[model samples]
Target: MALAWQGVRALARREWCSSWRQPAEWLTPLAFVIGVALMFPLGLGPEPARLRELAPGLLWIAALLASLLPLPRLFAADLADGSLEQWWLAPLPRPLAVALKLAVHWGWTGLPLVLLAPLLALAFGVDDAAPLALSLLLGTPVLTLLGGLGAALVLHARAGAGLLALLLLPLQVPVLVFGTAAAQGGNNAPVALLLLGAWLAVLLALAPWGIAATLSLMLD
Candidate 1:
């Protein structure tokens, strides 16, 4: 078991290194977060109170959208290059490998948004950074994990990117609501965070298997 996890970590690191070699894959989501944050103030006027009121939702929305940027590429490149076929044949459980890949995907795409959230929150006039950062930290993984299932489902479809967005956006609605509510840190914040955590836990347990199955079906 320990050895399997070690392989998972090693595979994840290799995937991260490959993505790092292509700057655009991981960087675009971070850029989207900043760009979307910038636009909120421009479109809504620069009132501190108003921006703060809107910041939770705005940032959550941006993070959600940015999460999607890497979905299509998650399995597309591996499929194209036959790496996925190799994975299928490996002694390692394919679902475990998918879990590691999704973890790395969140590390590249979602972790930055969590780290960057505090600064962006201040810019948008959110006074407390903890709630925002914590909410994103817990919530973004759910996005990436859920997205992995969607990405796997559409891996071989025509215009898979568009299909991915269409499949995922509806599922993301609950995440958006709970995440934004948690970030706002009001009376219901704890409840919202608990819900997000529950959702994350469920996804963590089930999504990798679903993704693995979908990808195998696609490949077959």
Candidate 2:
């Protein structure tokens, strides 16, 4: 057990280091999130009540789109450089490696959005940053996890990014709806969060294997 965890940590650290070397990997999505938050006010007018009203949905949409920016690059570089083959054949469990990669991806992309969401909420005149932060906390993982599945599904495709967006956006509808409702402090916040949590749990159990299998087939 100790050895397995060590391997997972090692792989995660390696992935993190590789990504850290490339500022654009994390920064581009972050910039997009910040840009959307800033731009909507100009287009929507500067009324506090109106900005507050739109903050939940607008921020959620921006976060969702920004999440997409990193998916295509998630496994592409590894595959191109032949590092993915080493991961698949390593002594460490395949799913664990995949899960670690997903965790790292979320840490870089989804986590930044969650942390910055409150500031964006504040900018949009949202007094209760709690709901916005909480909604993202529950919602972004779903995007990242299911996104891994889509990323793997279209890994070597001609237009992987377009296919990834098409594959993920429809499945992400429930998450978006519930996340927006939670951000808006609707009556169903608890139920919505619980549902999102359930969705995340399902992805955690399933996505790693799906990613590993798809990659295995493609690489073999």
Candidate 3:
């Protein structure tokens, strides 16, 4: 059990290291957060009060968009190198392997942005920072689950990562709606977070089987 988890961690680290070498992969998420947050002030004419009113909405949008940026390359590179096939051959349950991969993906991406939410909220004039931050925390895993689905689906894409964002963006609506609504005008973001967690649990349970079944059919 411990060894399986250790392998998962190692695989995730490899993904992280590979991505780190190609820094361009991060530009969209970083720019999207800063740019969208800045727009709140511009769109609301820089009135602190008005900016505060829209802060929760703006921050949630940024977080959602940021989380969406990495889905393409999340598994594409590994899949290209046959690492994904190696994972399939591991002695561990393939679903467990998929879950570990998702966990690692979340650890590298969503988890950091969640930790950075406070600064982003401030930039967007979010007076009630807790809600936006909490919303990000709860919602990012949902992004992972659903986004992982998108990532896995597109792992074989020849357009590479270019079309991934286009493919996955539409599927992110529910998370954004619930997440922003939770942060809109209040600090009670727990319910939305719960929903996100539930979504993640469902995906974690099902992703491996789905991926394995797809692979088996492809191999046949």
What tens digits encode model 2's per-residue C-alpha lDDT throughout 1-220?
8877777878988999998999899899999989999999999998989998989999999888988998998999999998898897677888889999999988988898888877999889887788889889889999998888889889989999999999999998888999998888868888888888888888889989888888888887
Q: Deviation in angstroms for 30 in model 2? A: 0.8
Candidate 2 backbone collisions, by pair: none
Q: Which order, best to worst by lDDT?
A: 1, 2, 3
- Model 3's number of clashes is 0
Candidate 3 residues lying further than 4 Å off, grouped into runs, are: 1-6, 19-23, 26-28, 159-167, 185-190, 215-220
What is the TM-score of candidate 1? 0.96
| TM-score, cand. 3 vs. native | 0.81
Q: What TM-score would each prediction reach against the true structure?
A: 0.96, 0.96, 0.81
Candidate 3 local lDDT, 1-220, one digit each (tens) = 8877777677667766776786666656767787887766776696777777677666767777777677767776666678878886766777667777777667667776777777777876665567666777777777777777766666666774566678667877777877887766344556766776787677667766786665444444
Residue 176 displacement (Å), model 3 = 0.7
lDDT of 3 at 159: 74
lDDT of each: 0.89, 0.88, 0.71
Winner on lDDT (1 vs 2): 1
Best by TM-score: 2
Model 2: runs farther than 4 Å from truth? Answer: 1-3
Pitting candidate 2 against candidate 3, the one with the higher TM-score is 2
Winning candidate number (lDDT)? 1
- Prediction 2 TM-score vs. true: 0.96
lDDT value for model 2:
0.88
